[model samples]
Structure formats: structure tokens, C-alpha cells
Target chain A: MSQKSFVWFCLLPLAVVTTAFFLLPMARLVVAGAEGPHGLAGYLAILTEARYRATLINTVLLAAATTVVTLIVATIAGMFLQRHRFPGRAVLIAMLTFPLAFPGVVVGFMIILLAGRQGLIGDLSNRIFGEKFVFAYSIYGLFLGYLYFSIPRVILTIMAAVQKLDVGLEEAARSLGASPWAVQRDVVLPALAPAFVASGAIAFATAMGAFGTAFTLATNIDVLPMLIYTEFTLAANFATSAALSVGLGLITWLILALARSFSGSAVAAAG
Target chain B: MSTAGHGAAVRIEACGKTFADGTRALDPATLDIARGETLVLLGPSGCGKTTMLRIIAGLELPDVGGKVLFDGKDMTSVPIERRNVGMVFQSYALFPNMTVADNIAYGLKIRGVARGERAARVAELVALTNITGLENRRIDQLSGGQRQRVALARAVAIRPGILLLDEPLTALDAALRDRLRSELNRLLRALGITTIYVTHDQAEAMELGDRIVVMRKGAIAQIGTPREVYFAPKDRFVAEFIGAANIVEAPVENGVLILPGGRLPIECGATTANATVMIRPETIRVTEAGEGILSGIVDSVSFIGDRQRLVVSDASSKPLNVDAPNTIQARIGDRIGLSIAPDAVRLLPSEPRD
Candidate 1:
């Protein structure tokens, strides 16, 4: 075979896999989205319909909150873990990362065990306030479950980034009469911008599309994944579900791209 | 230049450092630095020079009961941010996230200086440090020398009371280090700030220090002017550390040192049978065989640019090093006479090595 044909032969398996698994399904999903009664406008139904629009907004807000909170908590924890050495430090780090091994359904169950009617928080609140406090079946439980899994993922990235940080930078700032808070604000956070964008994007995207946790939890929570599942399985509305899935994927991709570009500019300006 | 008078005298009284893991980094030491005087802490790695510098800078507090005073005011417990001291780390420690101008202006900004004044100060420092047009460039875009200049400018821009430099030029190449050494000397003289410099390089210590403190094993071995330390080191460690010295152990009889090569006259009142003496290489003059006070065979000759360094064996217990003029012609295995002046030989008390 010629050199070009030999190169094509080398790429044959990748080409076959891409067409068979990725391109074909994506094309079918798009076509199926447009085949509803409303035609291509069916894709617009995600935004125009009140119930679908509420779910979209709710999911976006939850994912955004999860990203912001995860970054804050992880940055603090990672900095402390990376900078100090105490007895049992290795064990503490291992425990913090244990959530990464668990599935989303398991994380949701853990949250229920903490805050459900028969759980620890309910038991404590009952003794203190003479009333049971339960939020396991609500959107709050989903938020907690998302936080449980997101912290582990973000904390590891932040710890690695913190390890790469030049300690002299902080010391130089301190020598220049900068308070501890000012040093973190001006020097450390800017240096960690790339890491924040990378890990935060993963967390935001994960929270947006996670279905297992919502399925195991109450079905009444207004998340985009739960709405799509009901439309597909309960109502047997194939076109609407396919359109919603495409919308969800597109929105997540667009937001992630926007975040990456923004962080790219920030990193360049920082340098 | 008006800020020169604002320099604060520093006193470190009974300062020592013991790490949490039980490593003694610095022994209890007392030192007084005059206002506007440059003091250099000279030692090898793990010798506690950096620990002493950190103690003065308030980055690391000394052991309990130790006190750091600025112009007689107690500053022992004060944090570094409130100490109003400037420091230049070995890595230069220029903030990579900020431009040169921003980095220089950051300290002033933190002090709540207005935008207009901050810019004026930045411009003045940029001009002083010869980094004018490069102010807008990011730190990573500059060369090593430029980064060093920026770090210096940033430290001095704040007009700190005391400037503490911890091996500031150690990260640069040799040629750049030499050039920057003189530049830094001139800058420190111009600023006239009470400065404490730390380095393991003896040449840097000799050139930049008003007084050099030679340290060993977390304790100060000797402290004196460069000439004093070089010619009159108190012990063998200081004698060998500051410069090359030929330490001779020989017997003293009738006010003369009896060596393997020949007898040399001495001035110190040493009636002991055996005594140790230090003689510098440059002080030994190479003369004709059997003519000078001592004679030996020239084992090796190295022709350096400015001088010829010769190792003459059978001179004493060990071979003696002699730095002769480059113009002198000498070959290996040639018998050479070495003459050292009476004042050039120093009697050192015998001390056990650690």
C-alpha cells in the first residue's frame, strides 16, 4: 500500500468506532428531535414551554451553585491539606477522596441517610426542637448529593495545583506588607485560575446531566434529567425527549466552552 | 537618598530556632547591626544563615525569650507584614501573575497609596533600576537579570526600614552573578538601608559586607571585617572557610616555628612545644631554593590568568599552596623557596573539630 493508504488503514478502527457509536447516534437524535408535530420548532419547545423552561432554569441554577460552592470549599481544604502535615493527615485525605469511588445513586442514598425522616439530622432535630426535620426527598437533598461527589473531584485537582504553586510568591507578597487575605486574593487565586476552570467545568457538566441520583431520589424534583426521563418513559414522547436531550447537551457544551475561553483570557492576562 | 537617614538599627538578642521536628536550626546568638550598615551572614547549606535572616525578617520567630529590636523598639512578636521589612529571596520571587509595573506598585497599593503617587513611585524605581521600558512586560517575559532587577526595584520601592536579602543572586549564572554583585553593592550603598545579606559564597560575602559573620553548625564561628576575618580568623573553620589557608602544625622553639622544610620566625608568645599556624597562599613569596625562610619541591603549578598557584610539598605536615605572579616561570618538581612575613602567620589555638 502507498503511504497515504497505509495511514488510512491505521485510522480504520477509529473511523469505524466514531461513525458507529458517535456520529450515527448524534445524527439520529437530531433527526428524531425534528420529527415531532411541531417539526424543528420542537427543539425550541425546551425554552418556550413553561414547565420545560422551569426545569432548565432550575438545573442551570443548581449546577452553577454546585460549581461555585465546590470551588470555595475545595480551595480551602486543598490549601490546608497541601501545606500542613499532621498525624492522621494521610487518612483524612483518603477519607475525603472516598466519595469518588461511589456512584451518584450511592451518594444520594448517603444524603438520605444523613437527612431523611429516620436519619441522623432528623433524630437530632427531634430531640432539640421536638419535631422531625427532613429534606431528603426535596431539591435540597439533590444539591447535597451533588456537593458530596463534586467536592472529591475538585479537591484533588486543587491539591495538585496547590502543590505546583511557588511558595516564594506568597512569601514575597507578605514581605511587601500584604496581609494574608490580600496575598491569597492577588497572587494565589490568579495562579490557580486554570485549575478552577478545568475542575469547575467538570463539576458543572456532571451536575447538569446526572440522572441516577435524581432517579433514586424523589421524582417530583424539577431537574432537566428527571423531566426528560418522564417524557421518554412515562409519556412515551420520543421526539420531545430526544429534543430535550439535544438541548441539554448543547447548553452544557456551550457553557463549558464559554468558561474555557474566559479562563483562557484570564490566564493570559495573569501572565 | 533622603530615605537613607530613615534606616533602622536592628538588634537580635538571644535568638535561636528549633523546628517542630526537633532539629536545631540556629543556636542562641546576639548581634547588633548599626543603622545603614550592611551585614552578610556567610555559611554553607544547613549552616543556619537563612534561619538567622528569617528570624530578623520576622518570618520565623526565634525561640522564647529571644527579642528582635528595631531602633530599641521591641518587634519580636510582630508579624512580617507589620515589620515593614523588605526581602529578596534566592528565587527572586517576582510575581509571575503581574507585570513589572504592577509588581513594583503592589506594596504601595497595599499601603493605600493613591493611584497617581503609586505610578510616580513606580516610574522612579523603574528608572533607578534601569528597567524603564520593560515595566509593562510580564515577569516571565524578562531575562534572569531583568527579573532580578525588578525584584530589587519592588523591594526598594516600599522604602523599607531594613532590607533582608537571602542569597538573592545565587540563582543566576556565574558571570551575571559577578556583575550583579557589584551592582547590588552600589545599590545598597546608595540606599544605605540597614541590610542583612545571606550567602554561602565567600567572595560575595567579602565584596558586599561591611562586616561578615561566618557561621558553622548553627553557631557563629567569627564576625569581623573582611580583612580581619581573612587575615585573623579565630579558628581553623573560619580560616579555611573565608579563604584558602595553609594550616601548619609544628613545634615552636626560641620564637621560631620549626617545620619539615625549614624554620620560620613567629611573633606570638607561644612557648608550647607544638602549635598551629595559618598562612595565606598569596602571602607566601616564591624565591630561590635555600634562600627564603622555608624551601620545598614544587609538586604542581596551575597558571591562572592573574596569578600562578603552586603546591609545594615537604614544606610542612601537608603541602603548602603559594600564589605567585603569573609572570614567574616555575615547573613541577622544581625546588622553590617560600618566604612568609612574620605578621602574615597567625597563631591559632588548637580546637577539636565537630
Candidate 2:
């Protein structure tokens, strides 16, 4: 075959997959969002309706919180792990990243096993404080589950970034009369800003779209994913769920873009 | 610049470094650097020169009984930040996420200098390092030489008591390295900070050092002025390392040194046993065949811009390297006579075995 034809042939698989699996489903979802009882207004119900709007806000807040807390925890842990050497460190890192292989449902179940009504936290709290404390089926439980999985993904990126850091930079900062804290705040953190954005985006997007964890711990949770699940399966409200899915994807992408541009400007200012 | 003449006098006494991995990077040694002196730790790689610099910089602690005194104050336990030293890394570890102005102002800002004062200091340093009009430029946008200048400016902006440079010019290309070497030498003189420079390049050591401490295998080999070290090396290693020296292993009979081509008189050095003599290439003059004390067959000639280097065999056990004048007309396989002053032949203390 000619070179031009060979290039087109190489692209044939990607083109077919995108058209069949992505473009068609996305087009169908958009159409279905509009074909409800209220026509195109069904799509706007994601913002106009009280229940959908509240759930969307809740989901965005949870994802944002998870992303921020995960970045902080992961950055600290990763920096410590990358810089120090001790026995059992390899085992500790392996255990920390062990959650990366876990599905969202497994994470949700693990959260419940620790904080459910009949779980470890409740038993311990009942024995110690004479009052059972339980929070597995609420938004907090889902938040915990999101964090458990998100931390593993974020920490690995942070560790790699910390490893790539020049020890000389820290020494130089210290030589310049910067204290230890100043070294981290000025030199270390600014150098790792790109890594934070890259990994934080993944955590945010995952939390925003995650369904299994919310579904498994769905008693008092009202996240976008849980709402979409019930609207599609329980209430048979296909149009509303389809609209919510599109909104969820757009909001996650928008937030990640905003975050990237903010950090980009920050890096620009530093550079 | 008022801090020029009164920098710290650093004395490292019995300082040695044995890393946790059991690698003895430095042997216990003592040295005193005078206030405003430029001391260079010159050595090849893995020669413990950087280890000694780090001990002075307080980046690395010495073994037990080690003491570092700065102007009579014991500062062995002080960290690098509290040590009040300025360090320039080989990699030129300029903060990439900062403007050149911000980087230079970093140390001043850390010491709580006011914004206006910081800006003024940065401007002065920017001018001092010849990096004018680069205040707002990011580190990534700089050339290698520019980054080196920025690093120096940042280190000097705080008016540090001592300046530590670890192979600061090793990262640049040859032409740029040569240019920066002289510039750095002038800057060191102008600033007059008690400086500890580490480098493997002997030319850099010669140009920048008030006194050069030649190190080998984690121990101090010799310490003297560049001219002293070059003319009066203590051993075979220092003689061969500093510059091109043809090591002639011959017997000293009375005051004369016996060689394969001819015998030359020597004033001081190994008098009894077999003597290991060092003859500098530039010191050996090329005379007509049979006219001088020694004659040899020309092996090869290398024209080095200003001078031509001729390798003459039969002068000694090894081929003698002669840096004759560029005007001399000599070629491969030509007979050349060599002449040298008695003072030019340095008899090293150590005698090499056959």
C-alpha cells in the first residue's frame, strides 16, 4: 500500500472505535436528555430542579474536598517516603498503593466495615464512650471511600515527582538562609505544582463520576452519581440521568481546566 | 561591598567523613583558610574534594572529634542555614519557578529585608554579575552561562561570610568555561569572601585559587600556591595531575641526574636513591641536534595554536613532552636536542619502582 493509505489504515481502528463507542453513545445520550416529558427543558432541569441541583452541588463539593485533602495527605506522605530510608518502607509503600487495584465498590465496602452501624468504629465508640457512632451510609462515608482510592493514585504521582526533585535545590535554599519550612513552602511546593495539578485532576474527575462507592453506601448519600443511578434504574427516569451524566462530565472537565490554568499562571509567575 | 575585607576565617580541624554506607569519602585533615582567602579543593572525581567543601559549608557533618571553627566560634553543629554561608551548586540549582530577580532577592527576603531594599540589592547583584536586563527572565529561558551568573549573583546578594562553589563552571562548554573562570576569579577578588571552591579542572584551580589544596583518594596530597604546586609537586600524582609533566625515573649521582639521552644537573631533591624527576613541557627548550645536554628522535608534533608540542623519545624511559615555540620547524622522525635549567627538573620525594 501507499504511505498515505497505510497511515489511514493505521487510523482506521481509532476512527471506528470513536464513532461507534464514543460519538454514537454521546449523541444518543444528548438526544435522550432532550426527549423527556419537558423536552429540552429536561436537560436544564439538571440546574433548575431543586433535587438535581442539590445533588450536583453535593457531588462537586465532595469531589473538591476529596481532591484537596488527598493532595495534602499524599504530598506529605510521598515527600517523607521519597526522602527517607528505613526498614519496612518498601512494605509500607506497597500497602499504601494497594488500594489502586481496588474497585470503588470494594472501597465503599471497606469504609462500611470500618464505620458502619455494626462495624469497628461503632463497636469501639460504644465500648469507649457508651454511644455508638456510625456514618457508613452517609455522604461522609462516600467521601471516605473516595479518599481511600484517590490517595493511592495521587500519592504515587507525588512520590515520583519528589524523587525527581534535586536535593541541591533544597541545600541551595537552606544556604540562602531559608528555614526548613521555607524551603518546602517556597522551593519544594512550587516545584511540585505541576504534579499536584496532574494528579489532583485525576482524583477530582474520579470522585465526580464514581458510582459504585456511592451506590454501595447510598442510604443518606445524594451525589450526582447516586442520583443518576436511581433515576435510571429505580425511578426509570432515563432523560434526567442522561442529562446528569453530561453535566457531571462537563463540570469535572471545567473544574480541572480551571485548576490547570490557575496553576499554569502560578508557574508562570514563579518562572 | 563593605563586607569585602572582613570575611570569616574558617578552620577545619581533624574533619573526616565516613558515610553510612561505609565509604570513607574523606580522611581526617586540618586546614586553615584566612579571612578573605580563596582556597580551592582541586582533585579528580571521587577524590573527596566536594566532601571537604560540604564539611565547611555545614551540609555534611564530620566524624567524631571533628571541629569547624569560623573566626574562633565553634560552628560544627550549625546547620547550613544558620551557618550564614552562600553555596553555588554544580547544576546551578536556580529556582526554576522564580524570576532571576526573585531568586537573587530570595536570601535577602528570607532575612526579612524590606521589599525596596531587596530590589536594590537584586539590582546591584544583577549589575555585579553582568546579568543586566534579566531581572524578569525565568530560569528556563536562560543560557548555561547566564544561569551560572544568576546563581553567583543570588549567592552573593546576601553578602555571605563565606562562599562555597562546587564545580560551578563544570556544567558549561569549554569556551564558556574559560570565559567564566577569569570572570569568577575577578569576582572572587572583588568580593573577598572567604571562599572554598571545589573543582577537578587544574586550570580553574590555578586561576581562581589563592592557595590550592590538591586532593587524591580522600586525602590532602599537597597544599600551596598554584605556582608552588606546579613547580614543587610532592609526589608523582600531583606532578602528573596539575599539568603535563614528563616523569623521568633516573638515578641521581652527586648533583647530576642520569638519563637515557643525557645527564642533567639538579640542585635539590632525592640525592641518594633512584630519583623520580618531573620536567614541565614548557620548561624544556628544543635546541639543534647534538647542541644541548639531551638529544632524542621526534616522535610526533601537535600544533596548539600558540605553541607546538613535540614528543621526543630516547630522552628518558618515557617519551618527553616538549612544548617548544610555535616558530620552531620540527616534524615527526626528526632528531631534536633538548635543554633545561637545573631548577626546572623537580625531584619528587617518592621514588617509583621499575
Candidate 3:
């Protein structure tokens, strides 16, 4: 084969896989979203209907909260971990990032084990306040689970960025009469802006569309993924579930694209 | 002046640095830099010149019992932010996110100087640094020389009482470095803000410093004017470091230096049986063979544009590096006589231990 043909030949497998697994399913889902009794207007029901709209808002707010809290916690921890040396620092870092090895369902179960009706928080609250402080099967539980997993991803990215930061920048800022807080705000944070956007986008997108965590704790919550799960498996409403899935994917993608553009191409493809 | 009479009188009293890992970067030594003096800390890499600068700049605290004072006020416990200093790093350390204008105005903005005043100061600095038309450019968009200019402009924008620079021009190319050296020298002189510049380049030290502090192995070797250090080095290291010098270890009798090639006179009453002599290459004049005080056969000749360097053997204990004028006619294996003025030979206090 000639060079051009050989290059095309090397890309043939990728093309086949993309068509078979991604493009075809995505097209089918889009078509399926419009194949209901309401026809093309079925897609509009995602926003026009109260229950779906409420669930969409709930999902977005939860994801946004998760992204914000994760970034703050991770940035502090990552900066501290990167700058200082102490005994057991290696072990502490390893333990902090251990959640990266876990699936969402596992993270949800771990949250339950810490805050469920028979869990540690409940036992303590029951003794002190005469009431169990259970919050496991609620949106709070899902939020906690999302934070657990999101923090590690953001922390890794932030730690790498902090490692690459030049100490001279901080020194120069201080020499110019910038206080410690001002140095952090002006020099350190702005330098880590790209890392924040990249990792925060992944955290937001993951929290938006995550399934197993919401599935495990869906009794008192109405996240989009849980609603879609119920519509598909419980009610056997395939078209509505497919439409909601497309909505979830579209909102996540839109937000990620906005983030990437805002950060000037710093964001990678969202997980 | 050994010490300038005016900006901020800095006293580093027995300041030393021992990192937490127990590596001693600087020995306990005291130094006083006078107001408005541009004192250059000159040394090789790892010689603790930068450590001393950082101690004075308040970036690093000295070991116990050490103290730093600025204008009679103890500043050892004060952090760098409150020390009212301006620093320029070898890396430039320009804020990449901000435009050059914002960066130059950052210190003023932090001081609560109004936006209008900040802009005025930034504009004044831009003109002074010769970086016009670059106010809106980001740091990453700048070339190395331009970035250097921006860094310097940003550093001086604060009107700091004491300026601390750590190899500011070391990152630029040689030609750019040379040009910026004179420019920086002029700026420092104009500002007269008690500058502490740390560099490993001797030419930079000579060109900019009111006094050069030569350091080696975590200790200061000598502190003197450029001419003093070059002509009358206190030790072998300072003699070899400041400029090219031929150290001849030979017996001395009645102010005459006895060499392997011939005996030469010096302007010192050195009655010692053996003396270490430092002779600058340029001070040794090339004359016709058998006519001058010392003679040697040229081993090799390198015609550098302004002068020709001849490595002549049999002239001393070591092969002498003789810098003859380019107009001289001499080749390898040619016998030549060297005439050095009596004042050109300096008697070092000790021999080389390393």
C-alpha cells in the first residue's frame, strides 16, 4: 500500500469501532427520543414537564455543588501534600487517592456504612439527640459519594500542577510586597487555573451522568440518572428514558465545552 | 565607596543557612551593605552567594543567633512580603496570566495605590525599561530579552528601598546579557536603591558592583573593588576566579621572585623563603628573547581578536598564560622574553590547598 492508503488502513479499525459502538447508538438514541406518542415534542417534555425539569435542576445543582466542594478540598490538600514533607506523607497521599480505584456503587455503599441508620453517625446522634441522624438513601448520600470519587481525580491533577509551579513566582510576588493571601490569589491560583478547569469539568460531568451511585441511593432522590433508570427498568418507558439519557449527555457535553472554551483549551475530554 | 551613604543600610549579622536536611549552604558570616550601594555577590555555583542574598531578602531565615537588620530595625523575623524589597529572578518569574502593564502595576495595586496612579507608574517604568509598545503583551509571548526587561520593570515598580536580584540576566543569550548588563547598571545607578545582586559572572560583577564579594565553598573569599580584587587578590582562589592569573609558587629573596625560567622583581618586601605570586596575563609584556627579565618557549598560540594568548612552558612552575597584543609576531616553539612591571606581581597570603 502507498503511504496514504496505509494510513487509512491503520484507521479502519477505529472507524469500524466508532460506527458500531458510538455513532450508531448515539443516532439511534436521538431517533428514539423523538419516537414517542408526542412525536418530536417528546424531547421538549424534558424541560416542559415539572417532574423531569425538577430532576434536571436537581442533577445540575448536585453536580455543581460536587464540583465546587471537590475543587476546594482537593486544591488545599494537593498544595499541602505537594509542598511539605513529613513522615507518612506517602501513605497519606495513597490513602487519599484510594477512591480512584473504586466504582460509584462502592463509593455509595461506603458512604452508607459511615452515615446509614445503623452506621457510626446514626449511633452517635441517636445517643446524643435522641434521634438517628440517618441520611444514607437521600440526595445527600449521593452527593457525598460523588465528592468522594471526584476529589481524588481533581487532587491528582492539582498535585501535578502544584509540583510544576515555580517557587520563584511566589518569591517574586512576596518581594513585590504581596501578602501571603495575595500571593496565593494572584500567582498560585491563576497559574493553576487550567488544572482547576480540566479536573472540575471531569468531576462535574461524572457527577451529572453517574448511574450506579444514584441507583444505590435513589429512594429519596430524583437525580436524572435515577429517573432514567426507573423509567427504563421499572416503568418500561423506553422512549422517555432514552430521551432523558440524551438530555443528560447533552447537558454534560455542553457544560464541558463551555468550560474548555472558558479555560482556553485546558480541559481534556470529560470522563 | 565601600558602602553607599544613602538607601537602606542592611546588616547581616553572622547569618548562615543550614537546611532542614542538615546541609550547610552558608557559613556564619557577617556583612554590612551600605545605603544605595550595588553590592554584587560573586561566586561559582553552590558557593552560597544566592543563599546570602536570600538571607538579606528575607526569603530564607538564618540559623540560630543570626540576625538581619534594615536601617537599624531587626528584619530577621519579618517575612519577605513585609521587607519592602523587590526581586528579579533568573527565570524572570513574570506572571504569565497578566499582561505586561498589569504585571508592572501589580505592586502598586497591592499597595492600594489608585488605578490612575498605578497606570502612571506603569507607564513611567515602561519608558524607563525601553519596552514601549509591549504593555498589552503577555509574558509567554515575549522573547527572553523582552521578558528580562519586563521582570526588571516589574521589580522596580514598587520603588523598593532595597532591590534583590538573583542572576537576573543569566537566562539570556550572551550578547543580550552583555547589553542588559550595562542597561541594568545604569538603571541601578539611577535608582541607587541598595541593590544586592547575586551572579556567577565576573564581568557582570565588575561592570555593576560598587564592591564585589567573591565567595567559594560556602564562605566569602574576598570583598573589594573590582580593581582591588583583580590586582591584589587576598588568596589563590580569588586571584584565579576574578580574572586569568598565573600563580607561581617560587622562592623569594629581597623582593625578587625566583622562577624556573628566570628571577623577576616585585614591589613587595617578601623575605620569605617561598612565596605564592599572582601575575595577571595582560600585565606580562612580551619582549624579544633574552632581553627581558624572564624567558620561556611558546607551546601554543591562540589569536583572540583583541589579543593573542600564548601558553608558554618553562616560564614558571606551571605553563604561563601570557596575553600578548595581537600585533606581536610569535608562533609555537618560539623563544620569548616577558617583562612584567614590579607592581603587577601580587604576593598571595597562602598557596592553593585544593
Give the winner by DockQ.
2
Worst 10-residue stretch by lDDT in candidate 3 chain A? A262-271
Candidate 1 Cα misplacement greater than 4 A, ranges: A1-19, A123-132, A269-271
Ranking by DockQ: 2, 1, 3
Over A4-74, each residue of candidate 2 has an lDDT whose tens digit, in order, gives 99999999999999999999999999999888899888878888999888988988999999999999999
Q: Model 3, stretches more than 4 Å misplaced?
A: A265-271, B1-6, B269-273
CA lDDT scores, all candidates in order:
0.92, 0.91, 0.89
Cα lDDT tens digits, model 1, A96-188, are 999999998898888889998798999999999999999988888999899988999999999999999888889899999999999999999
Per-residue lDDT for B88 in model 1?
Answer: 92
Clashing pairs in 3: none
- Residue A48 Cα positional deviation in candidate 2, in Å, after optimal superposition: 1.2
TM-score of chain A of 1: 0.95
The CAPRI category of model 2 is medium
lDDT of 3 at B195: 91
- For each candidate, give the interface RMSD after superposing the true interface residues on Cα: 1.6, 1.9, 5.1
Of the two candidates 2 and 3, the one with more favorable DockQ, higher being better, is 2
Which stretches of candidate 2 lie above 4 Å from their native place?
A267-271, B269-273, B351-354
